[model samples]
Target: MTSRNPWSRPVGRRSVLVGTALGATALLAGSQLRFAGRSRAEGADPWAGWQPPVQSFPNTFIEQNVPIPMDDGVTIRADVWYPADESGAKVPGRYPVVVTTHCYGKALLGAMADYSRYGYVVVVADSRGTGASEGSFGLLDDREGADAYAIVEWAGTQPFSTGKVGVDGFSYLGATAAKTAATRPPHLAAANFGGAPTDPYRTFITQGGNWSSSSALWFALELLGVAPLPFTLNSYGGLDVQPRNPTTDIATFLTRLQTDGSSIPYRFAELQRLIDGSNNFDNGFWQERTTDVGNIDVPTLVYSGWADLFLRDTPRDFRALPLERGSKLMAIGPWTHYSLPKHIGSRNDQPIDDLLISWFDRWLKGIDNGVDRLDPVLLWENGSERWAGHDDWPVAGTSYDRLHLTGTRSGTSNSLNDGTLTALPAATAGSDTEVIDPLAGVCSRQTVQYLGGLPVYLPIAFFMPEFPISEFPGIDQIAPCFRTDDRANEQGALTWTTAPTGTDLLFTGPVALTLHGSTTAADPVWVARLSDVAPDGTARPIGEGALVASRRALDPARTKYSPDGDVVEPFHIHTHEAVLPVPRDAVETYNVEIWPTSWRVTAGHRLRLTIDGAEFPHLLPNASTPDRLGTLTVHYGPDRQSFLNLPVHQGAFP
Candidate 1:
């Protein structure tokens, strides 16, 4: 199932390749083990500060442009950060290695360096082709995963290393880390990463077979060794660059720029072919790209947030890991991609950095630090702002509750028709209509999420009205008013609202939306959003889902069903054989899988379901017919009622 060329050797012809060839065993053959301790540490922890968590080494040193050779003689390069003495010289002794791969040309993802001072060797590599490494850039390709496996093993077996390795990164790098972990490399001790989706096809490139323009564009530009200016915003504090890692210096950068000009066009062509062909399906090329964390055979710490773009997969990834593989942990906090480490309320009590440090220390250092005894799932409840520990994801006490749509008005938002959402079906059949809008979801938090949190701190909040600005150097730029507030984004949508609940209702997991409706066009796009409407009628989006009607065929085996046999999570078979045609006049059943969320709708707050035609820059319809944009008709009644399925719980998650 692993794709390998077994013959493409670009290292021989690469004009800009840096670093020298060294075998795994010979990498540190001449190096000798050296031990040095702090003047104040005969029996005490010297680097300890007023900080709650004590430190290890006083400083760190970088060994730039270290070569990570693959079996076929191709060379991958990395920058190694070694624990240092007070004077800042590499303390050469056996330590565990943590390898993180990046597609950025330079030291873009530098947060990995911070772990070096914690007594572990941290190695950051530029993934093949994107940086100075030699090969055609394979974005999330199996070959790249192959490269990650090589990097880990190479860093592991070195003389200065203890032959134990862990992988780290977020988003793109996180995907590569997951792949590396899946390979089950012998030296792979653990994996600590975040913001990764199991299937890149679902959120990164396409959603329910709907094309996501912004993320796709961002990655395309990155393959060319360039990035959108917006992506350069705060990176969870990953800005510490270590001098000139061959690929980062002025001379090598100019040369790689030239290489990108000649190579990226072909890369773009390759990506387009996949989009135009069978890769659009869930099982072919996408199957290879999907991260099967189940294949992982070691301890892992998968970090995520309810507000992340890939929220649906974070908990899913945790649930998939085999219990036979010792201990693993998943932390779901109130975070966006840029607000990655910004723990909110109960989460702050258990700092994210502290959790990561304790995890790696326990696994890599062979320390019995008792982190394994921590709850398998650490979650932050939104409205209540309380931390809850659970035995597993989806929580033990969760029960799927269905709420049907009706034509009666709730008088909530000023959407096309403020239809009613209820626990029971309507007595009589009715339909509400709304004209299709091609440009939607731009003025919402989704804009920031899909952009990888691009404008999180940018001062242009007024220009976009979607990004939060409160994080930007203590600037009160009206960002607090827009973070999840979705009134502007849903103005053109057709909505169904639930009357005020008698008590609090907690939605703690994946969500599904069923639409028994029809569109005026031959092919249509369905965008569904679940929002919490306060007593003041202010609606804030909680979760969202989208589907291209043509790819709506479901795979029964993989779909999740409730105890009552209702579909809780619809798994669609997106192959060409499964594609269905949309007739303008006939009503069809369409199910949209909303990304997971953890939020509470209070007693006075109502729940609103909004249906639109597009998510704009975030997603575009992938229709065969060019003129598929049309009006939508949502039907509600005992026979043809559409409804929203929620993962509801009454009290503590248990």
Candidate 2:
């Protein structure tokens, strides 16, 4: 059903000659430029202190039920917001169009009014088979990407359009922008891809080869949103039958999907099939859905948060985009997926819309605002609470510092400080072992105690508030009130603590755990976390990484090697092409890449590494059943040395 796209002609990118008109508008506008207020108590708003300028637009008019034709002949529904005057009449001049497409209907999108009022035509479209659109929805199917491109081209050709188009949104809409921009749409002047990850398999479904319990819920939500029934329609005003050829059956496909959804366990089974079937490599299925960042040649703006689920790959993809230095921008904020509004609301800042307007103002409207003159990297250091800009990520002068785990295996249960993390390795061989009940980790406690475990199967809409399970990202845990219980440290975790830092230690890059260890089971999963232990003993996680023993081989093709030749991929090892399973009861040196972090461990704060068998709910427990309990042994010695490699900014230390 692939149709030749007439508008698919590639548009070569112009050499954006960014003039040196640097403005005083702080790239990441914040109050202070110090290192003290970085880390917030768990659940505190990371964006509480900073205030960004709020840009508002006036005279917006909404036009609903616009039928956009895709190459596959499906009539996708869109809500177009156009610039209007106080007399309730359309503004005469044509303006650049910004198209935001998602499975969720247009009405839920709040940004449309803002963009439209500011003299741009904003089109929020419901992809085929969702909301008011036609065709059965296949999540991330190639057709959706094609539909996105068609929608953009359709908008570009409209009389109200200035023949320039831009795509923007978060999550699904971000993904739509990525796919559409990759196609090199002739009228797509720029794109703002935020919160949507470049790699779905690595960042979304199965991170580190470990499945998430929330997969089934995601599948159910997708199916529920896409089913043909009127009841399944998204929040796009209402479920009105479109005037165009009205042959849509409201009950048939809806009943089928609902019947399928009734067996919640089967949904998980289907999800597992996709994970296992892919064998964790970039297969046809993943490649079809994933955006080839290398092919994206537009002036793109990428955004992510330290606590956002899709946070890992956004920066990586931003670096991959084939745009000129000044053409691409990356902004990493402090709020989680949910707390973004709270953070922005606390400070009278725009909810990522200010940056969007500034970007669009420069690229689409041809405004010579100095946004292009600002540094490409804008980040919020967690503990420091200050916004900083840099020419590149892992800011210029970062160096890797390794902390060695030194101590012996002692008590039956893990003590808060069973082992020490030291600058020097143990003089002699030292080993520590801990028994793990895969289903009995930190997340399990929340599921069983805090919110009933039923949230695991319920739709996110039904229980996101109490469920606390936000897919792999876990945005609920970002609240200033949310702190990991000390009980998790006692339950089957091998703890390694360091002497309090005499002076502030600024760690602002990728982190990794090199483990010379062995597990009793063949299919063991290792969850590791790097935490900041405050002077008062409250442990807050700085970053976390995991590994599934069976999927340990690195895929050199997909793996991005460091420029200096030291192989480091922040967060997770980009390994998938080959499956090198762990030999039972054998010691292997695993170079496990933990997620990246930007934090400062102030003087008197100690660093800790807790290694456990599982990070439940966040990741599905080890494939092993309860009967096959496994014991993991972490080895540290001259022969089998293990350490946590942290990217430290020596220059930032005061």
Q: When superposed on Cα atoms, how far off is each prediction in RMSD? A: 14.6, 10.4
Model 1 C-alpha lDDT per residue in residues 1-654, reported as the tens digit of each score: 000111122233222122122211222463211112111211232112213334788777877667778876767767677899999898889998888887775355544326777888888887776555665566677888888888888888899899989998777778888999999888999888788866777766777777665456555546535321112212333333344524233344455557565336656675665556445666666777888888998899888877677666787789788864237888887776656334522325434666677778888887766567666776766776666666566665455556888888877778888888886667689998878777777676566666645454444545755444333421221344235477877688888888887788776778888788888866777889878888887887676788888888887666765423455677788877888888886899998998887787778788888888877767744434255478888887879868887776552111
What C-alpha root-mean-square deviation, in Å, does candidate 2 show against the real structure? Answer: 10.4
Count the clashes in each prediction. 0, 11
Best candidate, lDDT: 1
Candidate 2 residue-wise lDDT, 1-654, digit = tens? 001111112122111112101111211242111121222233344333333333334455666668887776768877777777876567777889999888754544534226866678888887666666766665666888888888889999999998989888776677778888988888889988887756777776666776654443356555544433322223222222332222333432354355443223444555767555443555666666777878887799988777666677787777678788779988877755444232322332444666677688788988766667666777776776666666666565555545788884322224533788876767788788877766545443223212212333234557454443322333445332234544355445788888778888877766767788888876677778767778767776666777777666665444433322223553334345455667767998676767777888888877878887766666654334342257888999888778776666532211
Lowest lDDT 10-mer window, candidate 1?
A: 1-10
**CA lDDT, candidate 1, residue 352:** 64
Candidate 2 vs. true structure, TM-score: 0.78
